[model samples]
Target: MPRFPEVAESSVGLSDAVFSRLVARARERGGKVYPLHVGDTYLDPYEGARAEAIRSVDHQRLHNYSPVQGEPALLDAILAHVDRRSGAALDRELVQVVSGATAGIAVVVDSLLSPGDELLLLSPFWPLVRGTTQRRGARAIEVPFWDRLESMGDAAAVEAYLESFVTPRTSAIYVNTPHNPTGHILAARHLDAIASVAERHGLWVISDEVYEELWFDEEPASAWMHPRLRSRSVVVHSVSKAYGLAGARVGFVHGPATAMQAIRGVQTFVTYCAPRPFQLAAAKVLTEGRGWIASTRAHYRELAHRAADALDVPRPPGGTFLFVDTRGRRRDGESAFAFLERCVDRGVLLTPGTASGKDFEDWVRLCFTTLPPDDLHEALARLRQVLDDR
Candidate 1:
């Protein structure tokens, strides 16, 4: 039989098996489901995105092929925004724009590691991080964090916990603050500990800050703002969550000039460049839309609280989702899939926590910003009813 190789087929990322089934069944049932599973926003693109998209329609350069690193205007605008926010003046030459955060992640993994090199990861992570590493023939050494992080208040203790998992083959560490699926933002001391460990080991740090602008209770923190880690970090940021521009598919990664050169080179074939019109639209948001960004963040913050209250979950300090702990709440012999199936039967769709990692097998994720206030309330009522009946 003609078949795929082991490396190509070994990981199918079936973590989403429950989600896929729910989606398929929802379509087959031929009616609407109250969706809290995805991170999509109920809002439109930012104030100026559509205007820029329209303006770029007649520009020939925006229509034709451009440098793989991205359009100059877009790159400068991004760096300017970064400098204003992080107080780190970066050289424009060190930045590379790509199709989206997903593409940016793939580019970094492929560019930074050789086959068999180990990439240290934090869990529960965005599944894409693990999938990309494995596909690049790299090993992922996971340090389970989310479960114990909130309880481990000491920064040095958190650093020590991460250090125990490191080995000689480890080449890089990935940090996702305002983390996906859980929406837990790492504290400043936690960021410092990770930075200290990375600096001491001479390991690369891939900082994913796509949710940088969505902090609700307090200001967000980043390793990019740390002086010691700046020389060896790849800071990946995006407009998808912040500006409601996910469909535009624009994101970028920047770091030390030397490493970015390699990352930029890898982009010559992979993605090549972000779509120009979208880049122009994103550039508008990056350079001149802080007020709009602040308002959007405020809106999501309000929704976050409402969702947390409805789900009976602790409100995350930041980000747009609430993580509902269903550990002892599940029926005997019921798997995460069965719990989610009941939510579906009750007409609300949620992302089973197992999809992100097994560490979260007893939880589920629900996004607050994805539905209107009343719809969100109704959706949670359905979810709550299912759990109550269980």
Candidate 2:
């Protein structure tokens, strides 16, 4: 049943507009629509790291294409930042700067996975990773995680549960923490379980550390820092989440030298290079934004607790979101989408939980950092009314 000039099968059912309908509804209603759906900060980035700070007068070829790998300055900064955070002495050749973590992961998928290969995607994950796998003609095997960590009991049990989902076709495991949606940071024991499973299967570990700098309590150890996972892991990082420079589109990926060779090759065919000016900006942030990160972390922690208290959910350990199960609060015969519509009617927008995982259809994800304190408080107040009315 082939038609002329048909699109690829992989593109089917993939959506880049998960929030379009809700956003349209919000637009129609007018007034202030608190955008709690997207994961972004209301605060501006550090002054020196901002795009406006980069000037043609200061740097040569400020708008030109950077080298395929990346600008040397940004790469050096990433190496130093990684060393400080994880204490790993990475070779300079092992790093590849890309447009962002999304594209970085895509390049990884292209390099490592063949069609029909499986990626062990821990859920509820960052929404885009699922589509990233699908676009590669690979399947994302969702193991209900993060939200189920406490109920899953010990690390051994977690390992057993994850391993049970693996099959001969599974080629890699994607790990993110402090996780999106739920915001639970994986402890060492959990990483041990993941490493054990990946090592036994000889599968690659794709460590997503974009939220690495956003932890609330103690600093979390990187997955690549684990002895067993070290050689097999390829870690991805972004300045977007921590520095509030999402529009800059700068992220870096590093791994074993051999694996990085293929990733860099794929990067050439993808975006070629991240924007040169933003690379300079990202370097500035990596080197000079620690104090900014500390103050922002404290601010985010307070906001996280406040939002959690308002929603009556457990406070997130890190990351920007609170994944709430709205099932209990739903009216009889009302669907998950209906509950979301009720919230939007009150001028508050939330991401449907089904965006994160197939098993999370009855849940909703809220970003406390998306709005400033006064606006966020008002949004929560409107949301509370909807919850109470049920």
The clash numbers for all candidates, in the given order, read 0, 0
> lDDT score of model 2?
0.92
Tell me, by lDDT, which candidate is best. 2
Show where candidate 2 strays beyond 4 Å.
1-5
**Lowest lDDT 10-mer window, candidate 2?**
1-10
- What is the alpha-carbon lDDT for the whole of candidate 1? 0.81
Write one digit per residue (lDDT tens) for candidate 1, span 226-276.
777778899898889988998888999998877898899888888788888
Question: Model 1 RMSD to the real structure?
Answer: 2.3
C-alpha lDDT score of every prediction, in listed order: 0.81, 0.92
Candidate whose TM-score is highest: 2
